[model samples]
Structures are given as C-alpha cells and as structure tokens.
Target: MDSQADLADILAGEPERIATGFQFTEGPVWHSDGYLLFSDIPANRIVKWTPDGKTETFREPSGNSNGLTYDRAGRLIACEHGNRRVSRTEPDGTITVLAERYNEKRLNSPNDVVVKSDGSIYFTDPPYGVSEAERELDFQGVYRIAPDGTLTLLIDDFDRPNGLAFSPDEKSLYIDDTAHRHVRAFDVLEDGTLANGRILVDMAIDAQGSPDGMKVDTAGNLYVTGAGGTWVVSPSGEHLGTIVTAELPANCAFGDSDNKTLYITARTSVYRVRLKIEGMKTF
Candidate 1:
C-alpha cells in the first residue's frame, strides 16, 4: 500500500503552541479535560498546557519523565526514565507507582507508554534514563501492566525501544527501535500477547537520525520522529513524506478540538502542526 502523504495537505501551516520554556522535552498527551500534559526530561518535571496557553507544573522531579498517556479513568500515566518506572497521576495530583521491577530486577528505564481500551498499559524500557549500574535489567523490554497490577514482559529483544503506539483497530502495535534505525510491527494476540514481530520500516542511517516517538492517524498513517523532521508512514510500512519543521521533533500526539492538531516535542521546545488526517485518538 502507498503510505506516503504530503503533510502540507493536512496542516494548514506551521503550528502555534499552547506553552513553552522547557529543557529538552518529550512525551506529550492530550486529556479529555482539554489540557495537554508533557514531560521536560532534563528539567525533571511534568508540565501542563491549557488551550488558553497557560502553563503550570504538574509534577516536580518527575523522575525525568519521558512519555505521558491517559487511561480510561482520565488519570495521567507517565514513563519516568530517571526512576526507571511507570507511574500514574491521580485526580487529586497524587502519584501512584505502577511498575518498577520485573523478575526481581529494576527496569532500565520506562521510555514511552500507551493505554488500551481494556485498561491495559504497554510501555517501552530503555537505558537512556538510567545510570550504568543502577539499571539492573540485562535486556530492554516492552512490558504490559494489567488492570490487576501485574507486569508481563512482552518482548525482551530490542536494541532500544523508544516510542510506541497501537493501530486504530488495536490489532497491531508499532514500536521504534532507534539504534537499529527501524520501526518494528507486532501482531497483537487475543490474550494481549504480541507475536509476528517484523521490521515495519527501515530508516536511513543519515536521512533520519533515529525514530524516537510516533503516533497513528485515523486512517492508520504513522507519524514518527526522525533527525530532520517527522516521517509519516503507512500502516503497512510504506514511507510517506516528512513533516518538515524547524526543530528536531522527539515525539508527537493528536490533540485539540477535532484531534487535528499534531503536538510535537522537539529539542528544547514544543511545536504543533495541523494535519489533514485527524489522529487515531479521535478515530
């Protein structure tokens, strides 16, 4: 299938942000309450951006939080690289630990996360957020957190899984393995197990630095972070045109009233662009 699309067709023009002043940010999530929550990794805090452009701190020393998502209950789920765990922010702003260890060893670092309709949590763990010794886990893994608070290791073999997202139908999962310069796809099994893992898109060594974060649109188009800009791909692994921008984008999500706003987390700043294709969150 042809997976290429001109980003210019969907986006009316360059994005106008709702917030700013972060030190190296990543992981952006849009909530039903009309607020955007994101992480400033180096600054060690989670910040909120309202539709009116007001910004506020969500969490202090956020364990170098890298990714954010919301469960069915509207609670904020965060992937903390510094603490090497995934946590949830309660409605009252209190924090709750979701997963920290597996098989008696601490995780390397939870890099990104996404929630399923059934209240299951899936996340990627890499070593970028951990010290050499503190990361006890030998291999980076993609894990699942059941509603009952059980942790299941989905995949243990990955160079460095950075960002991830599920297909609109939830039958497929797309994951970014940065070091290998490729995005892999997995078939989601009936029991929430993943199988048939294969390389979905092989990124160029020079054209794209590394795929960091990604999002899928309503039509199953995949928008991923690359060196130059965002690489738009099809669900079947075809390469689409790049979403050109000033800064190197790290991650993205569909937000705004119609879910047509693509919020991107770049180097030290955040940006947004309108997309012709609304994101899967709205689909």
Candidate 2:
C-alpha cells in the first residue's frame, strides 16, 4: 500500500452508523464474541450491538452508567453516574460495588473507568450526575481501587475530571479535566501510586470541544473526545489531527478480533470506523 494510503486506512470510509434513537450514548466497548456494548445514559441501560446488526439490552438500570470496560477476568467494570459509584459485573451475572465513598462521604459521581493489567481499577469522579446540593464531595477527584478492594484518592485538584487512560506501558496515566480543557499525565509509581503530574496537552482557547473521554492506542497515540470531535495526539503530545463525527462523541475503544476498529459512543447514536492502528489491550 502507498504510505499515504496506508495511513489513511485508519478510517476505512465514512463512519458507519450502527444504531440510533437512544436518549444518549456513551461508554462503548467491543467484546471478543463479535458484538459491541455501550451505555444509553438517559435510558438507564446498557445495549449490545452485533456486527450482523443485532441490537439488544445487556443490562437495565445501569446506574445511569457513563463508562465501561472489561477486567482481566472478563468482568464488566462500570462508572455509574446515577448511583455515584464504580461497580463490576461478574461472569455469574452478579454486581459488586467497587468504590462509592471516600473518607465517609459519598462520591460526586463516577464518570469514566479503565482497568490496569495489575488488576487496579482507575476512574474519574465528577459531579455531573448530581446537583451541587446532592454532591457531598467538595472537589472532583481521580481514584484508584486496588485488587484488595481498597480505594485511594489519586488526585483531587481537577475542576471536573472526566476521562482517564494509561500509557501502553502502564508507566504513565492520563487524566482529563473538562472544566480546565486540558489533559494531565502522571508517573505510575512502583507502589501503584501516582506522582509527577504535568499538563500533557492544552486545548486551544478557541477549540470547539472540552476534553471528556480518552483512550490510548498500542503506539501510545491518544484518541480523546473534545471539541469538534476526537483529537488524535502523539505520545510526545504532538497534535496529529482530529476525527470529526456527525455527533459529539463521549468515548471510544478499539474492538474487533484485530483491535483495529474504533467504536464511538455519541449522543443518541453509536458509530464505528476501521483503523490501521490497534488499541492497547486492557488484559
């Protein structure tokens, strides 16, 4: 393939609309079994769509979930906005609460989540799900849940922490602040703690979108949902370009057997595009 053509393969064609008519869609994840699962926040449920064009409900009253991912053991991990907690759905179809309170106060709302290879669960807690009167936490935070079920506050300085992901090597963690319109990187310490936080990218003041959800490819490039569409940034923080979508995307994930297909969850719909690059495997 021509070099340019090879690079252009990141998007096979116009984004294919898999389904529509949802109240609001977010948190798309591809299953190895040939289907994609995503959340319809306002509908309070998770929907599954197959490659063959089948759509069905995977779970109901999904706590108004916003983000979803699979753990090493194939359990479903979710960030619930309505319930203001992070939970895991076991293979046996049981739901287990992972994190809900910090220092005896209820969380503002768990907005996005990702699983580390070491079995640690990381998620962002913003107050988007509840009103100021119902929010018990004073500040938004990024939290980590250890394998032993211990919850630790990783960072609490963000105005609105929305999305999070780890570098391919797991040596760094990236967290985005919607209110600040910037993404920050942190060094992952040997003890599963984070330090050395710094701004990775500053969206231009005139940029069209605020930073929301993010994912990293195998090559360390970040696909972050922001103004105009998904902003693609190199591992070194260089602006590559943006993937424009018909609707504002909330989150994205690489799926398919090859992990080269990007599934996007936008308002009222879900879309997918085939990319030449593959996503970093969570397992």
Candidate 3:
C-alpha cells in the first residue's frame, strides 16, 4: 500500500487483530453503547467485541445475519440470509420482521443493509446464502423498506449486490456488485427511489478480491472492503489507496467513542486500526 502514505492522514496505525476463531465474519456495526457487533455467517451468530478486547455472543442462531446497522432511534436493523428477510431488533429485544417478501415472492438473501435518515431501510438481496432452487427472486435487487411498511425495489439489475451505504448528506447511495467487481453510485431521489446510476469505481485492476462491504467517512471518502484490502476511494471515484490486511477482510465499521477507530471483520478474526478521520456513525 505505497499509495497509503500519500493519504497518511487517514490511517493512524497498522491494523491489529483483536479476536479470532470465527467461521466467516461480516456485518460490522458500532453501537453507541460502547461495543462492536459483527456476524459470523456460517456459524449462525452475531459476536460482540469490547474495547477491553473481550468477545461475546450477541445473538445465536441469528438466521445467518449478514449486514447490520442502527436506525436513528438506535434499534438494530439486520439482513438475515437464512431467514431471507430484513429484521429489526427492538429496544425490548423483540424481533420485528421489516421485509420478507416482495410481490408475494420471497427474497433471495438479504446480504447487507443501511438505514436512511428518514427512518427508511435499504438492503441488498443476493443469492449467496441459498441454492438456485431456493431463491424466489429471479434477479438480485436493492430494496428500500419505507417507514410505512412499504417495500420498494430500488434497483433490480445488479449481478450480485453485496454491500451498500449512503453518503453523509444522503444524496447518494453507493452499492457494490461483487460479481461485476465494481461499485455503483445512485442518486437518492425525493421519493426514496434511485436514479442516475453510474459506475463509481472498478476493482478489476486488483486481482485479489471482489468488493463486499463498504463505509464512508465525513469527508465523503468511501472505505470499501475489496480488491485485496480496504480501498480508500475519493468521493469523485479515485482509488486513493488501500489498507491491505493479512487476512481478506469482508467488512468494516468505525467504532470507539470518537469514531476514529476502524474495526474490520476478516475471514476468521476481527481487526482494529486507528484512523485520523472520524468515520460516519450509524446515527
């Protein structure tokens, strides 16, 4: 990561492994209550990590949860791969099914999710958790669940929509297609539908890994986990640098009180690295 030094203001220190021994880690979200939660996909669980370097099971048999985020109200919104639905974990610990089917057809697999400032929820549906015969939606899609309980298909042509995030101003939605090995930016229109879809960055130049999970900084820079590491791309779509990790990281989140710590969920371990920039939090 020679280019990393060019953006040294972003990376404060090298990534350090915090915890290990998980099946397949993904979906890292920082809670305001001082903890980091992430999914161990094949293990069917969600793990919580603390600043003390302790690990605990936040949820077992999590329906194979993938991506996770907190709504403005601080409630957990999750994409469940095994359950084929998007669920919300309420403050009282009761689970609410936000989105499970569209047009009376079951979803393929909700791979990742994000919450809008308007209380709306968005998620990507791909068939990574199930077989072809088990999938109901013929095409992978990016969907939005309105606060009124309406499910709307935002984009349906993605080859394999894996991860997604909204810009700081909520003006743009960035989604990555793992199959296509590229990230696409979409205009978040007034009606919550998308428009002006365009490729933001292509990762084909790096032959190591495909795009999976993504996050953005306050400066509008995108921290996408792919192409052999975490690609730090400028808002204008320039690949500025990379945070190459020992293990192939699947997802990342900004945690700690100041939101200056980046937590990465690699293959079998959780890693953390300091950052000079304050990352955008869930709320």
Candidate 4:
C-alpha cells in the first residue's frame, strides 16, 4: 500500500475546492448533528460550513483557536492559542476551561487534541501560540486528561507536539511533531499512558511544510497534513501518496454522510475529496 495505485484505490476522486477566503484555516471536525467546523486562526473564529455550501461563523473571539474536536457527548473541544488553553463548549454553549496550567505553571499553548474511547482527553502542548518571553513550560509535551479530570504529562520530549489521533482499535496513538517534521507512534497502556515511542513517518522526504494535524482511516492509514498537501501513509510507515490541494493544507478530517469524504483545511480555503474507504470515526 505504498504506491500511487494503492492511493487510487482509496481516493475516489481528486481534491475539489468547497469553500475559500479564510485567514489561515486549520482544525477541521464534523459534527454528528451535521455541518463542518474549522478554525480561522488569524480571524479568531470557528467557521461552519453546511452541506448546502453555505458558510457562517460558529464562534467569534475564538481565543485564536487552532485545533478542534468533538467529545463523546457532542460537546466541542478546542485548543485556543491566544488564550493558551484547551476548552470545551457545553451543550448550552457555555465555555468551560479544560486545561490551562500544569504543575502550577501555565502551559505554553495547547495545540491539538483527541478523545480516547474511555472518555479521557489527550492533547499536545506546544509553544507555537505563545512567545518565548511568555512561555511557562520548558518542553513541549503530550498530555492526557483522565475521566475524573486529572491532567498528567505523558510525553515531554517532543520538539513541538501537534496533531494526534488513535488507531481504529485504540491500541495505538499517533502524534506528530511539527518542529521535527515526523510522526510518532506509541503503545497506549492500560492506564491511558503511552509507551514504546517510535518514529512512524518522516516528512523530510516530502516537499516543504511541516506536519501539523492528521487523521486516521478505518484501515489505520494516516492522512497527515504536511509538505505538499495531505499525505496518505500506510500503517507500516510507507508513504503511499499525497493529496494536493489549491493551497497548502494544515489539517484534514473525514466527514459527510458515510464518512467517505476527506475535508482539508488549507491556508485560506477548504477542500474535500471522496474516498472509497471510510474514515475512522472516534465517536
């Protein structure tokens, strides 16, 4: 599964522009109720796009949000850069601060997040959203929030931790480092901690941009946003192919009725392409 022909079996069509004219888009997620949500970092808003091709503002003064996901209860979880926190949008639309500090010190900046099957939350803490003078943490880390609301540092050696997702079976956790431009795999322990850290994909072999956000399909193939566009890599660490868009992509997600559409969040536009294989739905 490491060739263009292999990629052809997965991709049903080429990338097609769905929406455009955003200010640095990222963090795409599909809601069960319908519609898609993504971050416009510079614009500080979460824009919503419906099936009818209409786009509107989901939230403003988004705290300069960069990443977003939905919890099991259908609540919105977001990584806010300007606020340097990971927050959750409750059912009534009230904002709840999930994680803002660790060990009595404020976090550098929460970058991306994912929810495990057990209802715990996992997120990456990188300094990209903060300045050196204001940074509180010395190292970038991967953290887990227990179901009981406990925040624990799982990994603290990454240069700049970013996007992350779990395998279909939830036994493996894949996290990407933007500074190192590589993706790493970890064996998810019973206690929800990570072990056996190893490099899964090296983006240096590709074009230019670093890996930011990523998603996994049902077969465990990783659709990583990096380099030329979104890269499709096999579970065995092979680069199958790349999905190029009009603008360089920063993140992607699987959406639509059957979960067979790959939604990409490029620099200033959003793109989608049909896929023969369905994506791994966390919820």
**Best lDDT among the predictions, by candidate number:** 3
- Compute the lDDT for candidate 3: 0.92
Enumerate clash totals for all models, in the order shown.
3, 2, 0, 0
Q: For model 4, how does the per-residue alpha-carbon lDDT over 91-158 read when each residue is reduced to its tens digit?
A: 89899998999998999889899998788999999998899999888899899999888999999999
Question: What would the TM-score be for candidate 4 when compared with the true structure?
Answer: 0.97
lDDT of 3 at 146: 93
Pairs with backbone N, CA or C atoms under 3 Å apart (clashes), candidate 4: none
Q: Note the Cα lDDT for every prediction shown.
A: 0.85, 0.87, 0.92, 0.91
Candidates 3 and 4 compared: the better one by lDDT is 3
Candidate 1 lDDT, tens digit per residue, 114-223?
99888999999989977787768889899999989999999989989989999999999999998888899999998898999999998854664689999998899888
Using TM-score as the yardstick, the better of models 1 and 4 is 4
What RMSD, rounded to one decimal, does every model reach?
2.3, 2.7, 1.0, 1.4
TM-score of 1: 0.94
Clashing pairs in 2: 208-227, 209-227
| Candidate with the greatest TM-score versus the true structure | 3
Q: What tens digits encode model 2's per-residue C-alpha lDDT throughout 57-145?
A: 99998999999999998889999899999999877899999999999999998999999998999999989999999989899999999
Residue 108's lDDT in candidate 3: 94
Model 4 regions lying over 4 Å from their true place:
1-6
